[model samples]
Target: MMYTQEQNREVEKVMKAFADYIRDTQHFDLLWSDKVGYVFLDGISEEHDDFCMAPIILRDGETLCEEIIYHIACDVMEEKGKSHDLRLCGPVEREEIQKRLLPYLRQLPEYEHLVEGLFEK
Candidate 1:
């Protein structure tokens, strides 16, 4: 997850572009953590079950759009329990997410292409 100055800057550019894409097609208030390089969007409605919310994670020296979509899938699912169970276990860890949720998300035809097109070079 460690990146050089140039790498981080590049990621910021890609994420901002991604956010702009989300803004165009969806209604969300985006908040970003440059520290962790994740995009957080608020104001999601439960009525929109078809919506896919994923984090934008920069992997290795390149940004694969699929990985970003997978992270967002994980992000949305992790928060789902709050509405369903009404229990606050704690914040979900990135490692835990990648370990458990990512495998399932990779197969889903959800945000894969949407994010890929958004970050086209």
Candidate 2:
């Protein structure tokens, strides 16, 4: 999923907007990943929780990958209660998430067609 120049610009814009949103809303800095060619939103509050946006030229927006840790219910495990369960999800449709960030993305041009025809299939 290589990013075109324009696509990368959009990604940079969105990353800036999202980072700003988080900083303003949460009053903290996100622990960004140091990977040279990847965009990641690594939360500092907890380890192993990250939001990665991989650039895909086919779509105007990047593909999202979320890593989260879910705690097992008390009834599910007693000895393992303190253990962690990590779930890696997505490569999901950007449209499914773009809606929630509409307020931010809407500011960009082509907001209406940003996610058009942007599925892996």
> What digit string (tens of lDDT, one per residue) describes model 1 on residues 1-121?
5667877665555454455444553434334466765444533566654435554445332343344444454455555543222122234533343444344336433433443332232
RMSD of each: 12.5, 10.8
Best by TM-score: 2
TM-score of each: 0.30, 0.33
Q: What 10-residue stretch in candidate 1 is worst by lDDT?
A: 81-90
Measured by TM-score, how close is model 1 to the native structure? Answer: 0.30
Q: Model 2 — which ten-residue stretch has the worst lDDT? A: 66-75
Return the number of clashes found in candidate 1.
3
Cα lDDT, all candidates: 0.44, 0.36
**Best by the lDDT measure:** 1
Tell me how candidate 1 scores on lDDT: 0.44
